[model samples]
Target: MSAQLIYDLVPLGSTLVYTDGSPRPPERHRKKLAVWETRNSGGRLIRKQAEARVGNTVLPASITLHKGDYGNQGTIVLRVHQTFSVNSDLKFAVKERPAIGSVLVLARPGDDAELVHLAANRADAEEWLTRHGYPRAVFREITADTVAADAVEGRAAA
Candidate 1:
């Protein structure tokens, strides 16, 4: 699917995998394998930015994925995020979506809000919010109706 489809249909916090449609290189070709790895990997959808204009320049809409986190003993040291424009050449697929009854912890309330976390329930979401400080964060619960609509519309990973 195109990145635009992902931005439009796939819900935030869903697991996504993007590929350049190339076969994996043999391990012996370390350099080639390393390059291939960059073009093929999975991550959690986190943020989406709409098209914006800065002076005379126009920036295309984009989506950000949380690729990985590096840490030790509960301390996060590094976070890797990959942002892809709507016109990205790579193909993308939704690997998983937040299940019904799960709660989405969004950083803010709007189309551009980022998914900060996904909690099991309202109580869990409240507990998590107490621990993390996102003053303007909004919580959205996935409902059965939402799942039904997506399933009927063929929003599942393709």
Candidate 2:
């Protein structure tokens, strides 16, 4: 499924909200200004600057409120500053969903057992495991309905 990627250029003094419904106070280090420049093949140059917030925990500028996985729980909240639209194709690529007939593998450290990487196939996973010096890796086959079931379970848990 595709979704409309709508957002506003967060203003200088606006505060953002966290996913847990808490407000994040603006701070000096949390604010950042970035400048991007690009040159096209036709010799046209373009420059743009954008402001963003950075910290341990940062809130989203906009959100789709009250839309439950099972059904609609309440009315959607469309704030004035958040009301904007962009026409684009959005694909939600979940990591657990590998290509059909491929294998999903998790590379973990030998000493710490921490997940280092998730590879789509056994060959790539083995390569990563060897490169990272991981002792072992876990592999699972991707069936037709495996990804769909996992997605549904994830939504329900959330």
Q: Per-residue CA lDDT of candidate 1, range 1-158, in tens?
A: 88988877777878999999999999899999999988899899999899999999999999999999899999889999999999999999988888999999999999889988899998999999999999999998988775555543555435
Q: What is the lDDT of residue 67 in candidate 1?
A: 95
Top model number, TM-score: 1
**On a 0 to 100 scale, what is the lDDT of residue 95 in model 2?**
19
Which stretch of 10 consecutive residues in model 1 shows the poorest summed lDDT? 148-157
Question: What lDDT does the true structure give each of the candidates?
Answer: 0.88, 0.31
Backbone clash total, candidate 1: 0
TM-score, model 2 to reference: 0.32
Q: List the candidates' TM-scores in order.
A: 0.91, 0.32
In order, what is each prediction's RMSD in angstroms? 2.0, 19.6
How many steric overlaps does candidate 2 have?
Answer: 0
